[model samples]
Target chain A: MSILAIQNLYVSFLENTVVKNVSMDIEEKKVTAIMGPSGCGKTTVLRSVNRMHELSAHASVTGKVLLRGEDLYALDAILVRRRIGMVFQRPNPFPTMSIYDNVVAGYLLNGLRLGKPELDNLVEESLSSAALWDEVKDSLRRRGAFLSGGQQQRLCIARALAMRPEILLLDEPTSALDPKATASIEELLVQLKKTVTILLVTHNIAQASRVSDFTAFMYLGELVEFGASAKMFTAPQDKRTEEYLTGKFG
Target chain B: MTFTEAAKTLLWRQSLDKVFFGVICFFSFLSVLPLVLILGYLLVKGVSALNWQFFCRVPQPLGEIGGGIANALLGSLILLAVAFLLAVPLGLLVGIYLAENKKNWLADCARLSVEILQSVPSIVIGLVVYTWLVLPLKTFSALAGGAALALMMLPVSVRSTEETLRLIPLELKEAALALGVPYYRTILRVIVPSGLSGIVTGVLLSLARVAGETAPLLFTAFGNPFLSLALFRPIESLPHLIFYYATSPYAEWHRLAWGASFVLVVGVLFLNLTAKFLTRRWRVRF
Candidate 1:
């Protein structure tokens, strides 16, 4: 069954509609990828799901986003966002926070006090799940800013995983990382689907085809085609999707 | 060594440049000299008088020997503590509201008003407080004095806190908000802690500014020679006592005034140094 369903979504800034009448279903325990060029508003769709766009002074969203038949927009954002966590394009692991603290910042962000033992377990579990535990377990107390770029991105993923979010949104999580780190994150995402739903927004069609169970092709704020990743890449039904996949145009 | 060699004149040109740079360094040193001399003089003149008696004994009669600045010290404490209690939270809240929440006309008005208040002379502040508080209250008590000093400290704390809060990156706020933390809790837990060192520094600086002020106390505390335990009673603070005793014809009162000035300088310096030490220790954290 679909865990996340968007119906007739409309997103606008003043009079300009950026996303119009887009509808798609994200299945549970599967990685779904949205592929589009820059300015296609794929990131906007991701951000709107978690309500980060609410912070924008001019942006407004009108749509019903259902998570297991419950409207996400109508729920309190704090509760909604807890169930649906996001990792940004940039690795933002609170520069002053220690690597250990950065991993479990979601708990701290929610004001949940964990006893030392429980906190230690949470830190280990989240980092191991994000495929970063072995790399950073030794110097966990060191400042996060000292980490190399790839480690920082993995640290951000660990932070999101610490929340135990039911659904995770990655807005080009590997865009800022080197190829080695990107491959590591993509490998981790494949393993993560056993416990969580994942939605990835990216421009790399190859990455999407390799990691995603389902793929959605977006163009000019519209969902042009969406299906099983293998079928969509090999036997696309839409001419636009085929042309875009073949690099006829972005 | 002809016309071309004359223009090159290496020794002369080099000596002239060295002299010019040396003179500039000397001028910079000269600019900082007066403050250094005064601070050193205050340290030597003041610290020597900071004996246990200065904090223990009451001021003796005007002509008596071995009297202390205990009454003035206690009065300054009462005034400053109460003033800080009144000013710090209110000023910080307004500053946060201005910097984070509002950018409309009211915030603009508040900014302009604070600017005007900061530029107003301390003597003028004393005059205004005298008319506003002393007249209505019928007595220059600690409350009146504290309220006057609270006014003095508020603008300083607010301006500094606002600037510090502004210096914090917007990305931190966004990160917290994206985590599903409510905005208010995010501010209280994250934003406030992030800017805490700067806020504490601002409060300390404002406290330092308010402690040295004499004019506000002149109209509000009005200088009581005998120590009074009650906040409602008139008080003797160091600055006011200094003004009174320094102007008196008695030789003992003059010595006491210089000693009290010494005490005040040391106390304020210690507070400043303490804040600096604390902020440095906790500058980087989770």
Candidate 2:
């Protein structure tokens, strides 16, 4: 079943419309990759799902994003964000917080109280799910800034997973990492789809083909193609999708 | 040009650079010389007057010896505490507003006003506070003195807080917000903590700036001789004590003045060094 449905989504910042009349459905517990070149508005579409697009000054989003048949826009924005976690292109763990505190930051920031043992378990489970528990277990009290770039990104992932969100939105999460780190993150994404729906926006076409169960190709603020990843990669229906897949143009 | 001519020109430029470096180093030392000289002079002149009695006993009558600035010390502490309470919260809020709304017209206006307030003379602030609080209350009180100093501290704290918060990247705030934190909590919990060291440095520097101000206390505190703790009554402060004793004609009073000056200078120096240390030690790495 589809967990999220975007209907006629249009996003604009001031006078420029960036995401125009885009519509797609995100399947539950599946990796859905939004593939496009830079400035193609795939990130904008991902942000609109969690209502983060409104943070920009003069930005306006018009669309009905239904989360499990409920209108996401009609729901409280803060609650929507809580149910749909997001990670940025750059790894931004809270610099002031230690790794253990970062894992429970969602609860801490939301003013939710939990017992110590419960919190400890939550931190371990979340970190383990993000594949960072073993590496950082002994040094959980250290600041997240002390971690390497790849470790920081995993810490951010752990922080998001701690909330147990229904959907996780990633905006070019591996673009800033080295090749080995990118491979690890890609491998982790494949493992993560068993529990949470993943909506990944990537400029790298090869990355989309590698890990995504489904792919949506966007070009110049329009959704050019949406299909199963295997079918789309082998035989793209749209000329633009074929061109982008063949390295004819980004 | 010939290679020899070019080489000669290069040699001349190198000499000019060396001369410029020497000139800068000389002027830098010249600027720091006054502080060193003042500290040395105060130590030489004030050391004899500093004793256990000078710290614990009230000032003695004009011809007698063995006195202390106990009243002034306590009064200064009270006044500074009051001023810190009054200024810090309001200044931080204003600074956060200014940093968040960098392009807003009202924020621009507020920033300009803070700059102007910072440059206003301490004596003018004293006069204004006297008219506002002292004249209406019909008393020269520590409360009035505190209010005056708070006015002086506001601009410094506000500017520092704003500049410190502005140095934090927008992505940090977004990170917190993406976790479903409310806007105010994101600012208070994430943004403020990230810039905490810088904010603390700003607060300490402002406190140091007002700790030695005498003109602002002259009309408000009024320099009492007896030890009193009431906020509504006239009180003595170290700066006021130094000002009064330094102007008097007695040798004993001059000694007391030097001791008080030494104490005040040391206190200010300690605050400045603490600020510098915190800025280095507690700085958040991103």
Candidate 3:
């Protein structure tokens, strides 16, 4: 069964329809990739899944999103967000916080003061999982902003994973990293899939195909085609998908 | 040549730029010269006057001179302590309410009233407090002076708290809320702690301003040149004492007033400096 599903999702920006009638399902422990051109509502769809889009004053979304068979749109936003964590395109670790604090920020926010051992284990596990433990362990109390962009991005990912949400939503997680950092994050995501479902948004079909099991092709806020990643890349059913895959158009 | 490049190329001493810069800087220096000279003079005069006995000894009565301002020192401390106790929490809460729950009509009205209260003259505040507190309570007591200083303190504290709270990033609040913490708890735990330093700096800066207030104390804490411990009884304060001795015909009192002025200025300046220094050191890593 699908761990998260969307139906008839319609998002509007002021008077403009950015995403219309978009729907997809993400199976548990699987990586699902959403790919489209810029301003094609790819990030909007990602944000709506976690209800992050509702933060905008002029943006609105309609229809239902179900998480683990429960109606997420009808639930409390705080509850919905707890089960569905997000990482932004930028490395937005709380700048004022330390590396250790950034990893287990979820616990602090929930008022669960972990003992030294518990916090140490949590910081160790999350950082190791995000492939950042080796570099940041010694300087755990150092500010999060002191990390390089790639390291900071991983720390952000580690922060989200610390929440232990059912699924993690990444909005272009590696876009801000260097090629090496990007490759490492891509590798980390491959390992991360065993723990939690990932809904990754990327414009790079190659990266999407490398990391995702399922790929959904969207154009102009509409889902053009979606299926097994290998098939979708090699043999798409729609002309727009073929044009997009072959780099004929954005 | 482009208009911008032409302007840049022609920027020389003969241009209006140099003349304007010199004129503006000259007038600015002129405007600030008095304050600089006064502070310089006070430092030179006061440093020599600050003996241990000057602190330990009590002010000699009327005709007497060359004694410590123990009564004035203790009174200033009491007045400031009481004023801070009254002002801090009340101003902070009102500021937080104005910041967080900016629900159109009510918050707007509250903010507007706070602005008006902040702009009111200290003498008027003294008059108001004297009538309200002293008339009803029957004396220019510590409570009455404290009430006036507290009134002056409110607007500053509120503005500071509001600005500090606003400085906290919105993402931090969202991150807390997303973790299933209630909105109010998130504000109290995350936002408040992060904003604490700036808020404290604001309070200290305002407290320094309040300590220098003479007009409010004129009608409220009027100079009682003796050690006072009772909160409801008449009290001595540095500003009022300084004003009293400065205006008196007695040479002894006049020298004491200048000495007292030196002490008051130094105290306020020291508190303001320490507050800023401590705030810089108290930053949170986590």
Cα RMSD, each candidate: 3.3, 1.6, 4.0
Ranking by lDDT: 2, 1, 3
What is candidate 3's DockQ?
0.34
- Taken over the whole model, the C-alpha lDDT of each candidate is 0.86, 0.94, 0.85
**Which should have the higher lDDT, number 1 or number 2?**
2
Residue-level lDDT tens digits of model 2 in B168-279: 9888888898999999999999999999999999999999999999999999988899999999999999999999999999999999999998989999999999999999
Pairs that collide, model 2: none
Kindly list the per-residue Cα lDDT of model 3 for residues B185-243, writing each as its tens digit.
77787788788887888899999999999999988888787789789988999888888
Question: Candidate 1 docking: what grade?
Answer: acceptable
Off by over 4 Å in 1: A95-101, A113-117, A139-143, A178-180, A203-210, A228-250, B1-20, B47-50
Model 3 chain A is weakest, by summed lDDT over 10 consecutive residues, at A88-97
Q: Output the number of the TM-score-best candidate.
A: 2
Report how far residue B180 has shifted in candidate 3, in Å. Answer: 3.1
lDDT of 3 by residue, A1-250 (tens): 5898889899998999989898888888989999988888898999888777876777888888988779988898878777878887767776567889889988887777879898889889999989999999899998887788889889988988888889999989888789988998899889999999999999987899899999999999998888889899888999999999899988
TM-score of chain B of each: 0.91, 0.95, 0.88
Give DockQ for candidates 1 onward, in order.
0.45, 0.84, 0.34
A157-236 in candidate 2: lDDT tens per residue? 99999999999999999989999889988999999999999999999988999999999999999999998999999999
True contacts kept of 2: 0.75
Interface RMSD of each: 2.7, 0.6, 3.3
* Candidate number with greatest DockQ: 2
